[model samples]
Target: MFETLPNARRCAVLIAASLAAMGGAAPAFGQAAGQTAMPDSKAGAAKPKLWDARPASPNATINLVHLLVKQGVLTEDQAAGLIKQADDEAYIARQAAKAASTRADEAAKAANAAAAASEPKGTRHVTYVPEIVKRQLREDIKREVMAKAEQENWASPGKYPEWAQRIRFYGDIRGRYQGSFFPTGNDQFDALHFNAVNTGSPYDMASPYNLPTYNTTQNRNQIKLRARLGMEADLTSGFNAGIRIATGESNSPVSTNQTMGGGGSNFSKFGLWLDRGYLTYQAWDRNLVASVGRFDNPFWSPTDLVWHRDLGFDGFAVQGRYAVSDSFTPFGVLGAFPIFNTDFNAGTNLAQLDSKFASRDKWVFGGQVGFSSRFDSYRELRLAAAFYDFENVQGQASQPCYVQSSSDICNTDQTRPLFAQKGNTYMLLRNLQVGSWNNFGTTSLYQYYGLLQQFRPMTVSASLDLGDFHPYHIVLDGEFVWNTAFNRGLAAAGTGLPASVGITSPGVALNNRAASSDGKTVGPFNGGDKGWMARVTVGKKEIRQLGDWSVHAGYKYLESDATVDAFVDSDFGLGGTNLKGYFLGGSYGLSPNVWASLRWLSANNIGGVPYAVDVVLVDLNAKF
Candidate 1:
C-alpha cells in the first residue's frame, strides 16, 4: 500500500524531504508561500462543522455531494448512505401520502360496491355540483358576513333621541335684506298697529341737503342671529329636563326688559321671543309623558315656523296625553305668556297681553283634544280652538304720536289703544290642516291689508278633514276678527303715527290741510268688522329636515269696498308693509354644510305702482 501510495502525496512527501534536506521540513498539506492546501479528510470533517453555513438550495447541496465523491473524500456508496439519511424525513412523508391515497381508493371502492348492491327500485338518485354554484355560495356567504359586521359596527345613540335622555341640539339663524319703492322713503309699516317709521321717503329728492340723485330706491340690509339649545340627561331612569333661551328668530336672546322692538335702545331684535322649555317624565314607559314649563302649543301652521326645525318662544305650558277611552286617548295643551309678538317694525311692540280671566297678568289659553282611530281611518283627527287673550293694563298700551296725514290716532291729543277694543283683545282661531281635526266645519282663508282691507280682524274660524273623498288631504278653514276699537292710550300719548292710521287718517291734502280716522272698514259681512277672505294652497307641507338655510314666500288678497263713507281724506296706501303680491323663493345647499338662499318680493304702492326687490344671502355653520 505504501509503494502504491498516490503520486501527489508521494510527491508532496518528497518535496517536504527535499525541503528538510535543504533546511527544515514543512507540515503535511502545507503549500508553499504560507498557504494551506487542505486534505480531503479535513475538508470533509470541516464541512459537517460548516453545517450552519451549508448551501440552502437543493442544486447547491447536490453539487457539494458530487464534489466530495469526485475528490476521494467519500466513496459513492458512502455518499449514497448520507443522501438516503438526509431524505429520511421526505421518505416518511411520501409513505404517509401514498398510504392515505390507497385508503381513499379503498374507501371509494367499498362505497361503490355498497351502492351497487343496494340499488333501489324504480327511483333515480342524482348528485352533482358545478364549480359556478360553489363560487356563488362563497360570494353570498362573504357578503352576508360583511353586511353583518357593518351593521354591528355603526349603531350608535344620536343626540336628541326622544328616549335615553340624550343631548338635544337646537339652533337657528335668520337674515333679510330690504329694498323698497314707495312714493316717499320716510314711511314705516307695523301691521299690528297702524303706524309708519318715517314721514316721507328718506330718499325724497324734494327735501333739503340739496342732492340731485334721488330715485325712490330704499336699499337696506339686515342680519338676524338666533340660537336654541336643549339637553335632557337621565338623572335617574324615567325623568328628564331641557331648556332654551327665549329670544327673537332674527335677534340675540340678550333682549331688554323695558321697551321691546326693532333697532335703537330697545331690547328685542327680529322679534322672535322665547317660546318653549320643559321637564318630562316617563314612569309609564314614556308613552305617557307629562311636561310643564315653556312649551309650544301643538297647533299646525306655516307661520308658527316650528316645523322647519328652528323657531320657538318662552312661556309656561303644560301638555300631556290621557287615555280616556279605547277609541280615544285625548291630548291637551295649556300655555301662558305675558305677551305675544305683533310683527311690527321694531320695539318689543305688544301684539296682545291679557290673562284668561282678565287679570294684571298676560296669558294665552288653548288646547286640542284628539282621539286615535284604526289604520282604515289613517289617524285620529282633532278639533281645537285657541285664543291669545288681550287686555288693557291701565296706561299700558300702544299709541301713535305723529301723523303722515294717514293715521287714525294722529294730529289730535285724542288718545286710544289700537291693540284693543272696549276692554278685550285676543285671537279666536282654529287649526285647519287636514289630518289635524276630528268633527269640524270647512273654513276658507284669504288675507287682506292696507286701504280697503286695513286691519280687517281675523274671522273666528273652524275646520275639518273629509275622510278620503279628497285623499290628498283636503281641509276647510274659516276665521274672522271682530269688536274693533282704537288704542285711546296711544292717541293721548302723542307718539308719532304712520299714515293711514296716524294724524294722516284723514290724509293731508298736499299740505297740513286734512286729517281724520274715518277710513273704510273690513267690509262685506255682518255689522261686526265686516268682509271675509278665502284662500287655498296645494302641496304645502310642514315637518321637514331642518337646515341652517331655508326660505319661504306667500301671497294674500283682501275683499273690501273701494268706496268708503268713513273719512274724506281716506286713501289706503297698499305699498310697503301691506304685502299683496304672490312670491316664491328658495335656498340651495352648496357644500354639505354651507348653504345659500334668494328671495323676490312684490307689492303695490300707494301710487299704484308695483314694487319689487330681490334678496340673496349665504350662510356657513359649524357644530360640536
Candidate 2:
C-alpha cells in the first residue's frame, strides 16, 4: 500500500517514527497546515490517536485511511467516518464551481443580447466602393429628380430638357358678354347749342324749343374676347426676363377687349399687341428689383378707382422692400414712363416752314412710399402714398390748324391733335397763340385749342385683410386721389365778361369754346380737384382649386378731378371720372386655374346732366 501511494508512504513513515519514540503511546504530532493535532493519549491508552496519522494532502490522507481499513489495522466505522467527511467537502466545492459557471454564462448572454439590440435594422452590409464613385451616384440621383417642378412638353418624358427646365410658360384667356344700357332722353345728348355762324362769338343761348326728331340714346350689347400669352425665363442668379402678348389694338392704352362685331359681323381677326416685355434684376439679396421695358404699373393700386388695370407703362421702374422683422416691411417704388414721343427731323434753314415745328414728348414720372405689416398669420395691412406728375401733356384748348390760302373759314377740317379723353376736363387756353399752327391771328375754336390739363395727382390707398374669417373673409380698402392741376382755378378777373357765366349755362357751351371770364384760361369741372373712395369686400380671398369661390361688392365715388381721366377705372361710369356707382362681382373656380365670373356696374353721372348707365358682364377666365 505504501509503494502504491508515495505521499501516503511518506506520511506513514513519519507517524511510525513518532509512535516508536513515544514508547508506543499516542504521540503529540505537530499540527498540519490547518488541522490541530489530537491531545496526546496516555502511554498505555486503549486506542491510538488516528488524527496523528492524518496527512496534509486530502487525497494522501484518504488513501492511507482506506489502506488501514483494508488491512484491518483500523476499524470500518472509523475509516468510513473520515471518508464521508472528505466526500461531503468535495461535493460542496463542486456545487460552488457549477454555480459560478452558470452566473458567468448568464452575464455573457446578456451582453450579447444588448449588442444585438443596439445595431440598426436589417443585415449589416459592408462594401469597398471608392469615395468618388459613391459621390457620383448621389449626384446622378439628384440630377435625375424633378419633383415639384414644372414639366413641359409631356409628350415624351422622364423630365424636361435641360434648357426647358429653366423656362416657364403661363397665360389666361377671357371671353366676355357685355351689355350696356344708356339713358333714353334726347335732352342728355342734344341739350347744348353750337354757334357755327358767328366768328369770335360766344355759344348760342338756345332754349329746348325744337326737340330732336329721334331718341338718340342707343343701348348696345356686344361680345368681346381677351387672350394673353406670357413667358418667363430664369437667366442667371438673380436676373430674369419676361414677355407677354395680348389681344388688343396697339396704342389703345385703356381697353384690351376686342369687340367681335365691329364691322357688320365679318369674321374679324384679333390684333395681338405687345403687352409686357421686361428685364428684371434683383439686388440687395433679392429685396430690391429694377425693371426696364414695357411693364406693369409699379404703383400700389388697391382699386381701379384711381388707376385702370390694363394700363401698362412703357419705361423703367425700380422697387425696393426691406424687412425690419418677421411681420413688418417697408417698400418704395419709382417709375418713369414715356406717354408719347414727338421728334421731327428738320434742317436749320427757315425756308421750310412746316419742318421746324414739333411738340415736346409727353412723360409721366411716379413715386410711391409705403409700409406693410402682418399682425399674425391671419391678418395683414398695407398702406401707401403715391404721386404722379405728367410732363408735356398740356396743350392749348383752341389748337386750330390753318392753311395760307384759305383764311376765311379757318379750315375746321385741319385741326391740331390734342390729347383729349373722357375723364379729363380738357382746358381751353382761349386765344393763346401757339407756333405749331399756321399764323391765324387768334380767333381759334375751342376744340382746336383743347389743351390736355397737366395733372399732378397725389394718392393715398390702404387695404386691411382679415384672414381669420375662414370661409368668409373680409377686406376693407380705401383710396383717395387729389389732382392738384385738374381743377385749376381760372384767373378770370381782367377780361370784360358777363357775371352769369356759370359752368352749366349756354355761355360755357359744349359745341364751341366756353370763354373764361378773363378770356385767358378756363377752369376744369366745377368741383375741386379731389376724389375719394371706400370699399369693402367680404368673400374668399382666392379661388385656387375646385369648389372654391370668391365674391365682392363695393361702391365708388370718382370725382372729375380726382385722377387723370385716361387712367381711372375704365369700367366705372363708362370709363370716366365724375361718376358714382356700385359694383358687385363673383367668381367660381372650375379647376385649380380655371374659373368664371360675373360683374355688374350701376353708375350715374355725379354732377352733370341726368345720365345713367348700367353695364353687365359675364366672363369665362382660365389660367395655366
Candidate 3:
C-alpha cells in the first residue's frame, strides 16, 4: 500500500516493535526449545490483585494483599509470611491468604470468648401483636399500595412503579423488502415492513434507509415482523424505570440481530441491542419527579434518532406538573448527567478508545424544561426547551463553538473513501460483531479531533394537534449545541469551493472549513449554527381496520454544529458539506400489522461544501 504520513512522528509502530517496547512490562517465563511459557501470578498469603483483560501476558496482577490487610480481613504479618512462602515456589504468593485466614480466625474467636465472658448481661420484656391482627394489617397494607398505583395509571404518561419491576421493553419491528429505482446495497431489492397498503407505499418513508449510497436498491424489500418491545416499571412507584428493546433502525443498548455497521460491505455481524434504561421517582405522588440514568434528552423530534444521543450515564433529574386551572396542566423537567457510562453496544468497537467517555475524561452537564396543554376543543399542544454543556471542548470554525474533536471530518467512507487508513481495517473487526442497531451507523462518532473531553447542548421543540385539522399535527423542532471549546486543527475557511447541497459528509477538511469563523446563522443574525426542522402530517382514522394513511412533508436546515453524532454521505456522486434536504413521503394501511409507502428525497446546497443526491425508495413491512 502506498501512503503519505501526515506526521511521521505520530505513526503507530508495528505489532512486533510495539511488543518489544513493552520489555520488562511483559516478561516471558522462559521459552524452552520449540516451547511456550505461561506466566502465573505469585501464590502466598497475599490476596489476588485486580485483573485487566487487555494485553494478556505474565505479571498482570496489581497486588491485592495490602487491600485485604487494610480492610482487617487479614493481618500484615500473616499475609507477608504466606506471600513469602509462595514466592519460594515460582512467585504464586496469592494462595497463601487462605492459610493465614485460618490462623487469624482462631485467634480472634478465642479473644471474643474471653471478652464476652467478662462482660455484663441485660434483659427486656417483649410483646408481639396477635397473629390475627398482624395478618389483617399486612393485607390492608397490600390493598393500599395497589390502590395507589392504580390511581396514577389513570393519567396519560402516568407516574407508576412496581417494587419487583424497574425496566420496560418497547420497540417496533419491520417485516418487509425494499425495491429501488437504482441498482444498489441489497440483493433482493425489497422485502416487507410491518404494515402497508399495497406494493407502492411504506410505513416509515421518512427514515434515512439507504443513506449515502442510495443507488443500492438491495434493501428495498424488508419485513416488519416484530416492531418493538417496551418495558416500564417503577423501581418504587414515585420512582419509575423505562426501556425499549428491539431489532429496528432505532438505536439499542446493544443489538443481537446483526452487525449494524454499513450492513453490506459483504459483512455478516448480527446481535441484540437495548435502547434506554431510565429510573426516576416522584417526590409527592403527582407533584415532582426525580430520575437518574440514560434517558430522552427532552428535545422532541419525529426523526426517531436524536442528536446528542449518547445512551449511558449516572444522572440526577427532576420534573414537576402543576395545573393552573381546570383545563391546563403545565409540566417541566430538569436533569444533569455525568459522562461515565457502562451499557455497551451489542458488538465491540474498532478503536480501543471507542467508549462514550474516554478514560479520565472530564464531564459537563445537560438539562431541559417542557410543557403541554389541552384546550376545550380536545386539541393538545406542547413546548420544550433544553441545553447541553460540552465543557472544555470547542470548534475552530462557524458558530465559533467548542467541539472536542473534528468529528465532522474523520467520518468513515460511508459513501466512498479518498484514501485508506489503518483505522479502516480496524473497523472491519468490529463490523463482524452482532446486535447493533440504528438505521445509519454501526457505531456513532462523537469526537473527531480526539481532544474533546465533554459536550454541552441546548434544545427547543413544539408540537400541536389541531382538532379541526382532520387528525393533523404540526411539529417544529430545533436544537443548538455549543462546544464550550472548539479546537480542531484545520483551515478556518474555504477559498475555492463551489456551492453544494445535501452531502451528508465531505470529510474533515471540507466539513470543518465550511463553518467559517465568520458568524452566520439561519433567517437572522447569521442565525445560530444549531439545527432547525419543521414537519406536518395530516391523516384520517384507520380505513377498514388497517390504519391511518397520511401524506407527510417537511423542511430542515442543519448548520455544521456536529453535536448530532449521526451523519450520512452522498449516494448521488458529488459530495461536500453537512446535510440539508426535503423529505416527501407517506404511509398507507394494508392489514393491521402490514403497510407500505414510497418517498422521493432531494438535496442541493449543504454546509457551503458542494455535494448532491436524489433518492426514491418504496417499502413494505409486516409484523405479528
Among the numbered candidates, top lDDT falls to 2
Per-residue accuracy of model 1 over 1-624 as CA lDDT, tens digit each: 655744345444544565477563344553322233344575456543333334433533333444444444445776566556546745787899989977976787788768867987665655454687689789999989878655554333443323443555565433333333343433222112211112121111112123222233465444444344445455567777766553443232222111223455356343434445666666565555555665443433222111112323355555566665665555555555443333223222336452111123323334433443333463234433333333322222123222122221211111112222010111111111222121121212111111211121222333344345323344343332232332323222222334322322221111111122342221111111222223332221221324423345454332122111111011112121212344445554445434455545443322112233333333333222
Q: What C-alpha lDDT values do all the predictions have?
A: 0.35, 0.63, 0.40
Candidate 2: stretches off by over 4 Å: 1-156, 186-216, 345-350, 353-355, 397-420, 428-449, 491-527
Cα error, residue 210 of model 1, in Å, equals 20
Predicted candidate 3 versus true structure: per-residue lDDT over 1-624, tens digit per residue: 314421111111121133366441222323221232233333244364432122332321113333323333345675465446435543333347756866876787787777777777763324445697689889999889778767555332545434333454444454333222333323221221211111112112223353222122322333223345567875564766777555533332212122234344345443335656677677765578666766654334334213423233446667788877766767775656554232334113446564232223224466666667777564777777666664333222121122222122212112121111100100010111112332233333121122111234455667776656655444343333343323232222223333221111222222223333443321111112344557676674332237667677766555444342321122211111134667677878787756777766665434332334456656565544
lDDT of 2: 0.63
Please give the clash total of every predicted structure, in order: 82, 8, 159
Question: Candidate 2 lDDT, tens digit per residue, 1-624?
Answer: 555544434455654565467554322333233442333354235454554455544575566555444333456786677668667766887999989977976786787678678987884635355687689889887665533233443334576765677889988888999988876642344222221212133221222233221222678788888888999998888899999988864446778787887643578676788888999999899899999998888888888877788787789999999999999999999999987665464223447665354455678999999999999988999999999997766543323433222222222111222322353443223332334353333322222222334578899999999989777678998988887775343322212334233322211322212334463343233434677777777777777778778778888887655666667776776676767888898988888888889999998656434557889999988888
Put the candidates in lDDT order, highest first. Answer: 2, 3, 1
